[model samples]
Target: MTIFGEIAQITLRALLGRRRTLLMLLLAAIPILVGLLVRANARPGPVDVGAFLDAIVIRVVLPLVALVFGTAALGSELEDGTAVHVLTKPIRRSTIVLAKITVAGTLTAALLVPSTIVAGMLIAGLLNTRPGSDPITATFAIGLGVLVGSYLYAAIFVALSIVTSRGLLVGLGYALIWEGILAGLLPGSQVFSVREYVRGIAETLEPSSIESIVGSSAVAYAAIALVTASVIASLRLAVYEVRGGE
Candidate 1:
C-alpha cells in the first residue's frame, strides 16, 4: 500500500479498536431513536422533523462525534508517544497530517451521515414515499449537511489535537460553550459556529418554506467560504506542528 493508505489504515484500526467507538455508536443512534419516538408519538410533520434534525443531530451530535474521532486520530498517538515512531518515517509531515485528518473525517461521515438520513426519513415519513418530493429532498439535504459538518469538525479538532494534548476537552468546550451556548445566546456569534454553517447549508438546499428553522442563503455562501478557509488553515497548521515536533 501507499504511505497515505498505510497511515489511514493504521488510524482506522486505532480508532475502531478503542472502547470509545462504542460510545460513538451510541451517540450516532440518538437521532434514530428520537425519530422513532417522534414518528410513533408525535406524528411529526416535515417541519417538526427538520427542526429536530437541526437542533439535535446537526448542532449537537455532529460536533461531539467529530470531536471524539478527530482528537483521537492523532492526539492519542501523540499522547501515548506512538506518533514519534511515525514521525521518524521518511514521509512528509504534510502527508501524515493529511492522512490522519482524512481518515478522521471519513469515519465521522460514515457514522453520522447515515444516521441523520435514517432519522430524517423516519421522522418525515419518507420511507414509502416516492422520490423528487419535498420531504425526500429535505431529508437528503440534512444528510448532506451532516456530511459537510463532519469534515469541518474533523479538520478543526484534528488541528486542535496537534496544538494541545487536551484536544478533547478543548473541543468539548468549543462545542458546548461556544457553539451551543454563546452562539445561541449572542447575536453575532453564529457567524463563528460550525453548527450554524451546517444548518445554513441544509436550509439553502431544501425547498423554500415559511417555517424554515435554520439559516439563510447568505449564510450558506458564507459557510462555503469559511469552511474552505478553515480546512486549508487547519491542514497547514497541523503540518507545521508535525514538522516542528514536540
Candidate 2:
C-alpha cells in the first residue's frame, strides 16, 4: 500500500481500538449536551454573541476537550507501546507521526466544529428572542473562529503528546496556566497561548467585545508560531523510540 493508504489503515485501526472509540463518542456528546442545556434556559443578556460564545464554549470547553482527546490520541499509544506497531512498519518514521497527528487533529476538529455549532445555536436561539439582535450571524462567526483555533491547537496538542509521557497533566497546565491565567498578566506571553488566539479570531466575529482581552496581530502570530513549532518538534521526536515496546 502507498503512504496515504497506510495512513488510512493506521488511522482506522487506531480508531477501532477500544479506548479511542469511547473517547470519540464521549467527545462528540460534550457540545450537544452543552447546547441542550443552554437552549433550555439562560435568559438573553446584553452581550455580543461572539464574545459570549467564546467565553463559555470556545475558550473553556473546547480547549479542555482538546487536551483530553489530543493527548490521548498518541499518548495512550506511547504509554501502551502500541505506537511500536506503526513505527516498525515499512513507512518512514515521519509518516507514523504524521498519521497519528492526522487522526488526532481530524477527530478533534470534528468534535469541536459540530459541538460548537450546536452550542452556538442554543445561544443564538436565546439571543434571538431578544430585541434587535442577529444571534445567528454572530454565533456562526464564533463557530468559525473556534474551528480555526481548534484545528491549530489540535495539531500542537498531538505533537505534545509525542514529547511528554505525562501529556494529560502537561496539556492541562498548558491550557489552564499558560493560556488561562498567565497569558493575560504577562507581556509577550500572548505569543504562546492558544486561548488568546481563539479569542482574537473570535473578536473578528465581534470586535469590541473581546478587544480588551485578546489582540489581533499578536493572536494570529501566536497561532502560527504554536502550530509550526509543535509540528517541527513532533517530526523530530518521531525518530526516537516512543515506549520501546517488546
Candidate 3:
C-alpha cells in the first residue's frame, strides 16, 4: 500500500478495534430509533425535522462522535508511544497527519451520515403530508450539514490531540461551551463557532426559518478552519517529542 493508504489503514483499524466504535454506532442509532418511534406513534403535526437535525443530530451527536474518533485516532497512539513508530518511518509528517485525519473524517462520515439520512427520512414521512415544507430538501440539507460538520470537527480534534494529552477534555469543552452555548446565544461569537458554520451550510441549502444565522460564508470559514487545523497538526507531528514509548 501507499504511505497515506498504509497510515489510513492502521488508523482505521485502531479506531474500529476499540469499544468506542460500538458505542458510537449505538449513539448514531439514537436518532434513527427515535424517529421510528415517533413515526409509529402516528401524528400529523409539525415535525420540524430541520430543528431536530440542528439541535440534536448535528449540534450534539455529530460533535460527540467526532470527539471520540478524532482524538482517539491520534491521542491513544501518542500516549502509548505507538505514534513514535509511525513517526520514525521515512514518510512526510504532513502525510502521516493527513492519512490519520482522512481515515477519522471518513469513518465519522460513514457512521453519522446514514443515521442522519434515515432519521431525516423518518421525520419526512411523519411531517411531509402536512403542508408548505419539503422533508426531502430538509433531509438533503441536514445530511450535507452533518458531512461537513463531521469532517471539520475531526480535523480540529486531530490537531487538538497533537497539542495536548488532555485533548478529549478540551475538545468536549469546545463542543459544549464554545460551539454549543456561546455560538447559539451570542451573535458576535457565531463568527468563531463551528456549529454555526455547519448550520449555515444547511440553511443555505434548505432555508430553515428557525436556524438561519450565517450565509455561504460559513462554508468558506469551515474550509479555512479544516485546512488550518490540518497544517498545524502536520507541523506539530514533525517536531513532536517522543519519549521512546516511555
| Candidate lDDT values, in order | 0.76, 0.66, 0.84
lDDT of 3 by residue, 128-172 (tens): 443666777878887888899888999999999999988999999
lDDT of 2 at 10: 64
Per-residue lDDT of 1-246 in model 1, one digit per residue for the tens? Answer: 999999999999999975788999999999999888767776223345567788778778899999999999988888887887887778776677778878888999999989988988886673433333466577788788778778778878887887777899999999989987888888876777777777777777875311333567535644565456356535554454443455
In what order do the candidates fall by lDDT, top score first?
3, 1, 2
Cα lDDT tens digits for candidate 2, 174-197:
888888788878997776777667
What are the TM-scores, per candidate, against the unseen true structure? 0.83, 0.80, 0.94
- Best prediction by lDDT: 3
Stretches off by above 4 angstroms in model 1 are: 43-47, 126-133, 207-246
RMSD of 2: 3.3
Model 2, position 101: C-alpha lDDT score: 59
